[model samples]
Target: MSPSQEIELTLTPAQAATGVVIPVTLPSGPQRLRIPPARNGDLVRARVGDTEVLLRIHVSGPPAPAPAGKSGALGCLVALAVAAVVVGLVIANSDDDSTPTASSSPTAASTYTPYTPPTYSPPTYTPPTYDPAPAPPPTTEAAPSPFDTGTCLNGQLPDSTTAQTVRGVKEVSCSADDAHYRVIQRFPGTHDMSRCDANPRTEYGFSYQYTLNGSVINEYVYCLVGIGSYSRA
Candidate 1:
């Protein structure tokens, strides 16, 4: 039998959240209870908000009976299902591990052989031909005169008194038809007058050689080429 009188206790903040179950004598047998509002232990689970605060009981009682063969058989069936799942997991992991390792090794390279080109010998060289140049024309210098002579016995060539009586002479001659000859003289005379016969003792003069075209013989037979004092060679 149980007494009807009841007692109540308040909970501290730490004790309330920790689920510290307190068993008190209820004027009957020992009963478990929580602190806040002093609620029944079974009615108020040892939890505060979302947290479950585990609180074990150390009560004196008889041991419960063992499970029957039917319960054991059900447990064995569950254990076999779990074993099958574990084997499947092992096989899946093995496949993943083996496949990646096989593909990781590199493949072999292809073989190659080089081609050879044929050898060539060069042809002999041939040089071009050319003609020789023609020879140059010959060169020659004719000889100078050996005997050329003259003298002014009458002083200078152009005399003031005997200017009208002056005589011309051909002192030289050329052998070739294209060749010709002329004469020149020097004397002590001014530009306006020549002392051709100033004095027979003081007469001093000179003469030079020149040319007249032999091919134009008729046009220049008696032409006076140049005037000078006189000369003996």
Candidate 2:
């Protein structure tokens, strides 16, 4: 047989809510009892299991549960019934869809006709011809060169231009000014600059020749492109 007893206890504001299991002294030993939330200074007489308890609840937040115990119990029973009915309906619906038969399978009837999409052809396309924008006009400023006629006429560059490659008597254009060094003039001829034997340390110059050795021989005035050299071609 379960032992029963009557106990008196006071509940703080924190412990007065429903589902709060509070410890109480019993004839057998200390046992925890669950109760609903109550208002401050509320005197409650509720039987928790086989033990009867008189509780004085003090709470600061929400009002206590409805004072009529019989109506509250009736409302709980109605809620449980509604919940059971909803669960039963859900379970029935799930079971009905779990399996299928030949009769339940989708089938086309004699009057049914399959759908046919209309034939479509993309329109013929001819890509347009494209002509890119015209290139920028050629630069007017002439790049500096060895056979600059202006520098040659001005005597800015003379026989002191260095020859990277010497082709006998080939006329070339010049544009850069050799203003840093003095121009050394050479007598027109087809001669290696080494034959001139001019030292660039004291005097800098090279012997250059322009005009092809063909039917008629031709000569040109010399000019300068850089330091320590001349274009006498």
Per-model TM values vs. the true structure: 0.17, 0.20
Cα-based lDDT at residue 66, candidate 1: 27
lDDT of 1 by residue, 117-223 (tens): 68999989999888888876543434333222232122225422333333442233333232222322323213222332343332322232333432211111111
In candidate 1, clashing pairs total 8
Per-model tally of clashing residue pairs? 8, 14
Off by over 4 Å in 2: 1-6, 17-19, 46-51, 58-233
Could you list the CA RMSD of all candidates, in the order they appear?
Answer: 38.1, 22.1
Candidate topping TM-score: 2
Worst 10 residues of 1 by lDDT: 86-95
lDDT of 2 by residue, 113-228 (tens): 23477999999999999999999775455323334332332233333347554333323233435244333444344445453354343243334443332222433334223433
lDDT of 1 at 82: 32
Flag clash pairs in model 1: 150-231, 155-196, 156-196, 181-211, 181-212, 182-210, 182-211, 185-228
Q: Which regions of candidate 1 fall more than 4 Å away from where they truly are? A: 1-111, 117-123, 136-225, 228-233
